[model samples]
Structures are given as C-alpha cells and as structure tokens.
Target: MTMSITELEQALRALRLSGMSATMQARALQVAQHQMDFLEAFSWLVQDELDRRRSRLLDRRFTLSGLRERKDLKDFDWTYNARLPKREVLALGTLQFLDAKEDLLMIGPPGTGKSHCAKALALLAVQRGYTVLYREAHQLIEDLAEAR
Candidate 1:
C-alpha cells in the first residue's frame, strides 16, 4: 500500500530518533519537515539532480585550475572597468536571478573579459544549486553546425 505524507513523516521521525549522527538526523529532518509541501520538496530534488549533472560536467579536471583558484570576483580587472555598466550589473544581478531559469546574454568586444564574467557567473550559479553550461560562442556555433 502507498504511504501517506503523515506516515512518511512518522517514518522519517523514527529514523531521526534512532540515534543517527547529526548529519543523518538533519537529512531525515528535512524529509519529515517537507512532507506537507511535496511540490517544493520535489523541486528541490530535481534541482539537486541538475546540480549533480552540472558538477559532473564541471569536474575539477575539466576546469582551468588557475581561474578556479581566484576567490574574489574583484581580482578580475574587467569586473571593475567603468565602460561596461550592464555586464557589471548582470554580474551583480545573478543574486537576483538565482534559480530564475532564464537565458543570460553577455556581449562585448574581444579581450573584454566577457568570457571571464560568464564563467564566474556560471560557477556562482552552480554553487547556488542551479544547472549551468559554460561554452564559447564560437564553440557553441560549431557544435550546432556539427549537430546539423
């Protein structure tokens, strides 16, 4: 027989009270606490799956170690330049755009760090549990061409 939400919550509570570690208790608590909001709980599960996929795609071996080492976004000069107000705004806007599921466009002249900012934002997105893809415009075009 299928279990109801209250039954699932009771089972989870039992697991938590079974002398589990703090970590396990916390995990069990989340399951028990969200039983009433199944849709939100399901969305979190889907987001977690997407995050796992993105992590696999962005495995350390595949990333530029040097770029990944830069901890502060301010270290990049383009992040400060006055000419590109919109890109900077967009960088800041990522906070507002968290889990927004919208396309982002960054356009600029060559050597302007458009790619850098995009990479940084994509990294941030992944950290915030959103799925992300980072690719050069030319490479994406070529990929589409090959697919056709």
Candidate 2:
C-alpha cells in the first residue's frame, strides 16, 4: 500500500528517525522526478540521518564544554610570534595526543597567543567528539580551590 508523505514522516518520527523524516519530503520529490531511484533515495535518507545525529552530537559536546569562544587554528596569526613554530602548533590539531592519552601544556610570555592556541585546540577536541573543559589559569585555580 502507498503511504502519503505525511504518514511516512509520522512513521519515521515514531521510529525515532527524525533525520530521515526531516528530509523525507525532499527525497520523495526527487524520487517522483526520477532524479533518484528507490535505493539511492534510501541511501540519501540514511546519510541525512547520520549527518543529523553527528551534528547534534557535536552541538551537545560544544554545550557541555566550558568554552566561551569558538576558535580555529587557522585563525591564528603565524607572524604574531616569531619564535612559535607554526608547523608544530598546527600538528597538535591532529589530536593524536588524545588517542595516546597525553596532556598538552603551552608556555610562553604574554601576547604570545598561548591562550588562543589552547582554546583552538580545545575546540578541535570538542569537534572530534572529545569532552573538554577550558579555563584560564586564574579561573582554574579558583575552581580547584572551590573544590577543595
């Protein structure tokens, strides 16, 4: 039996597949226009669901992280600090340290973009599905004292 688009969407929502439900009308249109076959449409719906879940997960992670600012390593000024090695700093974004279970420490004088790099790396970690807590040195000390 053929189901209406609304009925199919309701059924998908009931199955807890909101992602597929959301794109159902569009995919149906594509199918009706013969732009996509049934199997191809099914694949697109599944991919849409996966993408939605991944986006939601990233949003959740970002919310849980105490990051006040969204930073990207690419936004960093390589010319700001002549002593800072650009290649080495960019490599940290690879996040291999997370897999190896290692901690990162950045040390430098003021105006050296230490905080910027740290925050950017933390953002990267969050995007990669890792839990992150970001704090300045003073704030970190305060949190530690409060916990004691």
Candidate 3:
C-alpha cells in the first residue's frame, strides 16, 4: 500500500520512541513506502556509478596484474641467456617507468627480439590498465613530422 509522508513521520517517531537500534531504524525507513524503495534503488545506482569512476581512475594510475598474458612472455628464455642481466633489469625498469609515465629505450642488434620485447612490455602495461602507445622509432618520428 502507498504510505504518505505523515505515515512515514509517525513510523519514525514510533521507532525512536520504542528505542529501536540504529540498524532497525534504518531498515524501518527502507520499508516505509514504495517511494523509499525507489530512493534506495536510486542510491545504489549512484553508488555503482561512483565505483566505476573510481575503478577507471585506478586503472589509469597502475597496470593491473591481469593484463599480462603468459603467452606474451613465453618465448623469452630467462635461464641460460647471457643477456639476462640486461633484459631483467630493463623489465623491472619498464614497470617502474610505466608507473611514473616515463619513456624507455631498447637498443640492440637486429634479430634480438627488440620489437617482440617492446610489444610484450607494452601489452603488460595495457594489462595494468594504463594508456599505452607503441610504434617503431622511425615511424613515430615520421608521424610527428607529418603532423607538424
């Protein structure tokens, strides 16, 4: 049945007079009327909106661990590789650089998986929910010149 404002006020008064606990008083308010139910539903909708916004901001701030696919890092043999020291340090540095919104440079001989490593790292950054852009160094410069 519909509950008028006056009825709601009476219920509230009764609840207070009866010394109902705060939790019970809140539940009583929720059950006061169909309108109260609508209000509660609207509040939940707003809360969901806020939560989504917060999640987006967090995603922008840090790479989410979920973004790194195992396949991406699979080809690299971490063991028995003489270059392990450099690549390992670079990987750790890449994570820190991503967090700080910094740049990374990978210079090495051809056929050394430079592009593959770059793509894997970029993908990792993407998994972390960070905004990422990737391009060959020459192509990026070309684009910049064209834009200018």
Best by lDDT: 2
Record all residue pairs in model 3 with backbone atoms less than 3 Å apart, i.e. clashing: 63-128, 64-128, 67-127
lDDT of 1 by residue, 31-146 (tens): 78865355555556445545655566556533532234323355567545568665655556456655565567878788776666666666665565555556678878988999
- Model 3, span 46-142: residue lDDT tens: 5554565566665654343333333356666556346646557456535888778677888877766666667777766665666666777887899
Task: Let me know the TM-score candidate 3 reaches against the reference structure.
Answer: 0.45
> lDDT tens string, model 2, 1-148?
9998889989999998999999999998899999999999999999999999999998888888888889899898888788898888888989998899999888878899999999999999998889998888889999999999
The prediction achieving the highest TM-score against the true structure is: 2
The C-alpha RMSD of each candidate to the native structure, in angstroms, is 10.2, 1.5, 12.3
Local distance difference test scores for all models: 0.57, 0.91, 0.59
Off by over 4 Å in 2: none
Ranking by TM-score: 2, 1, 3
| TM-score, one value per model | 0.47, 0.90, 0.45
lDDT of 2 at 38: 95
- The local distance difference test score of model 1 is 0.57
Q: Clashes per prediction?
A: 0, 0, 3
Q: Which stretches of candidate 1 lie over 4 Å from their true place?
A: 1-72, 78-80, 86-93
| Model 1 RMSD, rounded to 1 decimal | 10.2
